[model samples]
Target: MPVIRVEMFKGRTVDQKRQLVKELTDAFIRTCGGTPESVQIVITDVAKEDWGGAGILMSDKYPDKK
Candidate 1:
């Protein structure tokens, strides 16, 4: 089985996330020749504050902060 983990800044619309998962899963299936049941898609959405970059919180750089 293949387990894929995708991490990104939170606040994406549900549609976007779903599409991303679907596309990625499809890619894996195509390359690795696996069935949907054999491939696992895991998405971990992190708050900008939880992710730091270049000595600054990602939230500070992105307008996604709330």
Candidate 2:
């Protein structure tokens, strides 16, 4: 089994996540010779305030975000 972990800032819709998993599974199977069912994916969502970059929090970095 191939295990994939994806970490990103939160806010994607369910449909987007569904598509991401499907495409990832397909790619993995095609490249690694494994069944889709044998692939495992874990998505971790981090809040803007909880993640930082360039010595600044994402929430603060993008304070003007809509």
Candidate 3:
């Protein structure tokens, strides 16, 4: 069994996440020789405020411009 975990900033649509998992499953099966049924994927959506880079929170670094 292969378990894949992806963590990223939130805001992706459901369709995008669906496609991403499907493609990831396919790639894992192709290269790792595992069945789709045996593949597991976990997606974690992190808030910008909770994520940081260069000693700055993502929320502060990339504020919503409106």
Estimated TM-score per prediction? 0.84, 0.88, 0.92
Top-lDDT candidate index? 3
C-alpha lDDT values of all predictions: 0.86, 0.91, 0.94
- The alpha-carbon RMSD values of the candidates against the true structure, listed in the order shown, are 1.8, 1.3, 0.9
Give a tens-digit lDDT track for model 2, residues 4-66: 999988889999999999999999989888798999999999888998999999999876466
Q: Can you tell me which runs of candidate 2 are displaced by over 4 Å? A: none
Candidate 3: Cα lDDT at 61: 93
lDDT of 1 at 29: 86
Ranking by lDDT: 3, 2, 1
Which residue pairs in model 1 clash with each other? none
Model 3 lDDT per residue over 1-66, tens place = 778999998999999999999999999999989689999999999999999899999999989779
Q: Write model 1 residue lDDT over 20-59, tens digit each, in one string.
A: 8889889988988979788888889898889998999887
Off by over 4 Å in 1: none
Residue pairs of candidate 3 with colliding backbone atoms: none
Which residue runs does candidate 3 get wrong by more than 4 Å? none
Q: Rank the candidates by TM-score, best first.
A: 3, 2, 1
